[model samples]
Structures are given as C-alpha cells and as structure tokens.
Target chain A: MIRVVLLGAGNVAQHLYTALCNQTSVEVIQCYNRKGSKLHPDQKKELVTNTLTELVDADIYILAISDDAIEEVSSNLPFTNRLVVHTSGSVPMDTIHSSNRKGVFYPLQTFSKDKTVDFSTIPFCLEAENEKDYNLLKELGVTLSQKLYKISSQQRNALHVSAVFVNNFTNHLFSIGNDICSDNDIPFEILHPLIRETADKIATMNPDNAQTGPAIRNDHKTINRHIKFLSDTTQKELYQTLTKAIQSKYGKKL
Target chain B: MIRVVLLGAGNVAQHLYTALCNQTSVEVIQCYNRKGSKLHPDQKKELVTNTLTELVDADIYILAISDDAIEEVSSNLPFTNRLVVHTSGSVPMDTIHSSNRKGVFYPLQTFSKDKTVDFSTIPFCLEAENEKDYNLLKELGVTLSQKLYKISSQQRNALHVSAVFVNNFTNHLFSIGNDICSDNDIPFEILHPLIRETADKIATMNPDNAQTGPAIRNDHKTINRHIKFLSDTTQKELYQTLTKAIQSKYGKKL
Candidate 1:
C-alpha cells in the first residue's frame, strides 16, 4: 500500500483526503495544516498534524497548498529524499525545494467547494525527478483517475494558461451573458441550454469548424445591432474586441 | 394537425424540418429554398419548391431564412393575412412584411450542421401580432419542445445578443484554448473535462460565484506568467484584456 502525508487544508486538500481514503491500495497517513482549525473535521484526530515536524513517514508527501507557500513548506518538511509533490498547475516541479525528491501531482480540474468532482475523469498531470517516482505517482494517479499525463513544468504551465482561458475566462463570458439578461429583465436560465451546447460541440468537432455567429459570418448588420443594443461601455468594448478577434481568427480583414 | 410551409435551407431551417417532421400534430407541407440546390436531399422533391409563388396554402409559413431575406421573402409571399414567422434571434417580428400576420419563432440555441440537438430542452422564444397567432406558434413550439416563452420582439432581440456572448463568443474562447494547446504540443483533449465542468458548474451556480482562477484571485504573478508564455501578440492582448475585465468585474482595483 502507498501511504501519503497530505499537506494543506484547502479545497484541493480536502478533496484529495477523501479520494485517497477511498483507494484500497492507498492510505492518507496524515493531513497537515498550519492552522489545525482548517483540517478536515472527518479525519481522525490522531492523523491530523498542525506542525511540519509531526508529519508521519509516507511514500508520498502531497502538498495540496497555495502556489506562494509551496517553496517555504517544502523546504520546512522534516523529512528529505521522499517523493514530495504539489497540486499546482502553474507552479513548477522544482518549486518543491531541493531538499526533497521534488515532483508535481497537478490535477488539471477545477475544485470548487461543496462540489463533488468525478475523479475518474479528472486528468492528473504528473511530473517527477526520477523513473521510480514517476511510476509511483502514476500508480497513485491511476487509482483516482484514468487519465495521467507525464507533463513537464513548461508544458503544464501552458496547459494551466489554456485552462484559465477555457474555464475561468469562459465562466466570465457566462457572467457577461448573465449581466446582459438581467439588464434587459430577461431570465438567465434562458441561456443555459445554449451554454451547455457550446461546450458540448467542442468535444467532437474542431472549434475552428464548429464556430458560428455574426463575428465569424462577418454579418456587420447583426454585429452592429448587437453593439448598439449593449448599454454598458465595458461590455460594448468587450463585444467589439471579441468580435474583431473572431473576425481576425477566421482570416476576415478589418 | 397544423400545416406549415417552411422557407430557407440553412441550419435552422433543416433542423426545424427534422424536428417538425417528427411531431405528430405538425406537417411541414413544403420546403422552399430560393436556390433549389440548397434544399435538403431527404425532403421529397414534390414538397420542395424553389419559387415562392409555388408555395401552397398552409396555416403557417415559417421563414427560417437569413435576417436580410426575411423582409423580401415575407413581402413577396403569394398569400396574405396568414401567420408568417421567421426563425431568427436578431430579426424583429415586425421586419416581416405587414401583408402577413408577423411573428418570430426563434429557437435560442446554436444549431450546427449534423449535430442532432435535443429539442426537448431548447428554448423556443415566440412572438406574434395577435393572441391567436401567438397561441398557434406556441402550439407548434410545444409539439417539438417543452420550453416556450412569450418574449416580445425587443426582449427576443436582447436574448439574441446574450446568446451571441454565451454561445458564439464562448466558442471562440474554446478555439483560443485549443490554439494554446496546439502551440505547446499538448493534446487539446486534455482540457475537455475542465471545459465540461466549467459549463456544468454554472448550470447549478451563478457564474459570479462559479468564477475561479488567477485573475479573479488577483494573482498577478500567475497572470503575468501566462501573458509572457503566450507567443502570439493577439493572444497576449486578449489575455491582458480579459484579465483586466475579470479584475474589474469582481471590484478589484487596477
């Protein structure tokens, strides 16, 4: 069995604690949080540690902490030469400090509070300093998910940026749609089906070919109408900018 | 059974034809395409009419045509004072010629070619000149889908603009994400689960509370790193603009 000492008590940490507990071949030996108050309440009191020195010996030390705290925490770890990994997409594997066998166990999925994510489909992007560590991470990852990518720091960084675009920014666009609906006294639920379909299309089709609407079609009449319809200055500017971006994407000249 | 003459041969028209054909209480008596070559091949040759004058008498003449053509087609219709509607999100109902009882039967969802949409969940926004025409349109709408809203021409116009943001603009963002993945030699599919979950989250939660990432978190370090990582000038500019927009949205200072 692979034993793990989970670090941090944030969303990712709580989720990791639950997922690891369910794995027949894995045991979350301990969960460490700087503030003991933040640790999962369901975890056994004995298995919760407030100080780094009290962390039990484990096969993997999973640092499910914030990006800024990664360096300090890894450097402060009581043990060295063990596989230490962080669940960060942007932070590099090397950020875990040279005192330990640094690696990354980034789950490329958004972890929202109170939401139960399907770990089976969440792609776990793994990186390590050696073959044994890599295989060990993979073995642990496989217990939680089917997708495990051996990504480097550089590639994972790119993926994180891409993710920000697709997930974070896309949600922002949905917010804009919500705002537009509210301003016009329309229900936001009206756009739910369209939102779902937009995401569904990309699963099978190339987005380039899947793209539709006035911006891609260069329907200036409709585009101008939409621009005039939007009352907010920022939203109008965003509309124009994204319209231009889409037009340019499809090779349409200004 | 309600008899209908369907006009135009675009994505919307084709999808409507298939959907209406499946409804036991509706009969799409004729499919008219100004250019005969655009007509659906599966439609019976007898039911396909290129010339508007050859359009047979029906309870409703559905113009699922381009926005620009809605005016001319409705004006030249061989009949008068009948329920004539165009399935366009942007086009106002009155744009249809006064010679016919004007209405709008806008299905507020992106209709892609060969993508069999689940008509049950698609919101059909209906508007007409009179209560009788409105009821007739709703009858037809309900035959195909459960969602039917008596939205005004103005409200429908607003919904159309909002659809552009949520559906069209959101798809472009997906395209951007795909490009980033391609540039980094990362398979775009790696981002699919994240994309699905992002859309899924908003179905249950408000987009405002659903928003997450470096920009919303005001993590300038990761945001700056992402901007630097993007090689394309336009992509970088888009990244900066969207980042600023998100910060501004959540009341964060510049």
Candidate 2:
C-alpha cells in the first residue's frame, strides 16, 4: 500500500484525508500542521501532530497549504529525494525543494471545510517531474477521483483564473441578485431554482450556446430600464459593463 | 374548469401550454398567434389559430409575447372586459388596454423553447387589479406550480430586475469562464462541478456567507496575477471591474 504524509489542516488537506481514508489501497502516515488543533476532530489522534520533525516516513508528502506558505513549508520538510506534491492550482511544482521529486496534485474545485465534496466528480489536475512520480500520483488520483488531467503548471495557472470567473464572479452575481431581492423585500429563495437550472444547462450545452439575455439580444429598451432600475451605483455600473461585454461577444458572432 | 387562452407561440407560451395540458382542472381553449407554424407540433390543430379575430372565450387570456409587443398585442385582443394577462416580469400590468381586466401570470424562470421546465418548481408571480381576478390567476397558478407569489406590479418589476442579475448576468459570467477556458486550452467541463456546487451552496446559505475569492479576501497579489494572465482586453476589464465590485462589497464590511 502507498503511504502519504499529508501536510496542513486546511480545506484541501482535510478533504483529501477523508477521501484517502476510504481507499483501502492507500494509507495516511500522518497529518502535519503548526498546531494539532487545526486538524479535524475525526482525524486519528496518533496520526495528527504539530511538529514537522515528528513526520513519519511515507511514499509521498502532500503539502495542502496556502500558496504563499508552500515554498517555505516544502523547504522545511526534513526528508529529501522522496515524492513531494502541493495541492495548488497556480503555484509551480518547482516551488518544492529540488532535493525532492516535485509534483502537483491540485483538485480543480472549490472546497469549503464544512462542505462534503464527492471526489469522483472533481477533476484532479496532476503534474510530475518523472514517469514514476507521475504514475504514483496517477494511482492515488484514480483511487480518489474519476477525472484526472495531466496538466502542466502553466495550464493549471490558466485553469485557476478561469475557476475564479465561474465560481467567484458567479457567486458575486448571485449575491447582487440577493441584494436586489432583499432591497425590494422579496425573499432570496425565489431565485434558487433559476440559479440551479442555469448551472444545469451548461452541463448539457456549452455556455456560448446557452447564453440568453437583453444584452445578447441588443434589446436596448429593456437594457436601459434595468440600468435605471438598479439603485446601487456599483451594481448599475456592473450591469452596464457586463451587458456591453456580452453584447460585444454575440454581436461579433451575429 | 377555468380556461386560459394563451397568446403567442414563443418559448414561454409553448411551455405554459404544455404545462396547462397536464392540469385536469385547467383548459387552454386556444393559442393565438400571427403564425401558427411556431406552435409545438403536439398541440391539437383545433386549439391553435393564426387569426386574432378567431379567438375563443376563456376565463383568462395570457399574452406570452415579447416585451416590445406586450402593449400592442394586449391592446388588439379583439375582446373587451375579459381578464387579459401578459407573462412578462419587466412589463407593467397597466400596459394592457383598459377595456379588459388586467393581471400578470409571470413564471419567474428562464425558459428555452426546446427545453422543458418543471412547472412545479417555477415561481408564478401573480398580480391583478382586484382580488377576484387575483384568485382566478392564483387558482391557475395552484394547478400549475407549488410556488405562487402575490406580487404587485411594482414588486414584480423589482423581481424582474433581480432575475436579470441572477439569471442573465450569472450566465454571462459563466460564458466568460468558458471563454477563458477555451483561450487557455482547458475544457470548460473542468469547472462544471464547481459551478454546480456554487449554486447549490446558496440554496441553504446566504450568498454573502457563501462568497469566497481573492477580491473578497483582498488578496491583491493573486488578483493582479489573474488580471495580467488574462490576454483579452475586454475580459481583463471585466475581471478588474468585477474584482473591484467584490472588493468594495466586502472591503466595507472588513
């Protein structure tokens, strides 16, 4: 069985620990953090530690820390020439100390520590310096997730920014929707079904095929009315800007 | 049984017709349009007509036409003092000619002509000048959907604008995400699970509570990197604008 020392006790680390525990073919040697209290309560007490020197020997060390902490954390690891990977989408694998075999095991989905993720549906973006390291990561990935992408560091960076658009910006729009509803004394629950369907439509069709709105239609009358209807200055500007951007995209096509 | 004479053969009109067909308590006496060719093929030919003059008697008439055409079509209904409603969120109920009773039977969800909607989940924003007409529309809504809101013309207008933010603007952000993925040679499908989960999260939590990203966290380092990483000028502008908007929202709170 392959053994792993999971570093950090954040969202990615905790989620990976949960999924890894389900794989009979793999074992978690230990979970390391600056403090043991950060580790989930369900984590085996013996397998959780705050001291970096206390890390057990393992086939691989996965650093699931924040981007800024990655280089220093990898440099602090006492082991060398063993497989070491960080679960970051934007950071280069070379950030790990060159003394160790470097790889990336970025999960291409947003994680909230409180929310349970179905690993089978998430795409694991993997990169490694050697064939053996790649295979090891691939083996682990296959056990945890159905989708595996052999992405370069450059590709992973691009995917990260794209994710910000779909997840981050989309959530902001939903927030603005909530703001608008609450401003007018309407409950936010009324918008839930539409939001769910919007995401579902993109599954069966590309977003380009699925796009529809006054902006795309160049329906100036409706567009102006909406702009006037928006009371918040930021929301108004946002409405105008996105509407123009959408118009430009489809206007070129039409 | 209460009868609805559905006006127009557009996406909303056709979907409502299909839904109304399933309700044993409601009947669609006729579907009025300038051209019957747009009518769904499964609709009985007897129930479809191209002439406005050939309209049949019904308890209510729903003008499921375009926003620009709502006023004109409602004015030319060829009948007087009958309950006439237009299925538009943005249009005011007063747009209907004064000769007939006016009401709004708007289903607050995006409908594509080809894709079917689960009527039971869609919110029917019902509005009328009087309680008698409101109850009649409410009776129709009760037969079709579980979500029925007694919204005023003013509240309905506010809901329409809110729907634009949640559905129209949210979809555009998704399209931008797809564009970013395509530009960087990443398949848009990689982001689907994240997109689905983002929407799913808000069903149980408020959007503000669910929001997470660089701008919300004020991570200017990552934000600048993403803006520089984006090559398209328009996409870059959108990124900066939305990032600033998100920052302003949380920056105030922070």
Q: Which has the greatest DockQ?
A: 1
Runs with alpha carbons beyond 4 Å of true place in candidate 1: A37-40, A252-254, B37-42, B252-254
Q: How good is the docking of model 2, by CAPRI class?
A: high
For all candidates in order, the CA lDDT equals 0.88, 0.88
- Where does candidate 1 chain B have its weakest 10-residue lDDT segment? B34-43
Q: Write the per-residue lDDT of candidate 2 for residues B41-95, one digit (tens) a residue.
A: 7777887888888899999999999888988887877889999999998889999
Write the residue-wise lDDT of candidate 1 on A1-254 in tens digits: 99998998898998888888899999888888977643556767887879888888899999999899999999998877888999999998888889889899998898987987679999989999999999999999999999999889999998998998899989999999998888888889989988988998899999888888998888898899889988888788888889988988787433
Model 1 fnat value? 0.83
DockQ of candidate 2, scored on C-alphas against the true complex (2 decimals): 0.83
Clash statistics: count for each candidate: 0, 0
Give the TM-score of candidate 2 (chain A): 0.96
Quick one: how many clashes does candidate 1 have? 0
List DockQ for all candidates: 0.85, 0.83
- Candidate 1 global TM-score: 0.97
Span of 10 residues, lowest total lDDT, candidate 2 chain A: A35-44
Superposed by TM-score, candidate 2 places the C-alpha of residue A236 at a distance from the truth, in angstroms, of 0.8
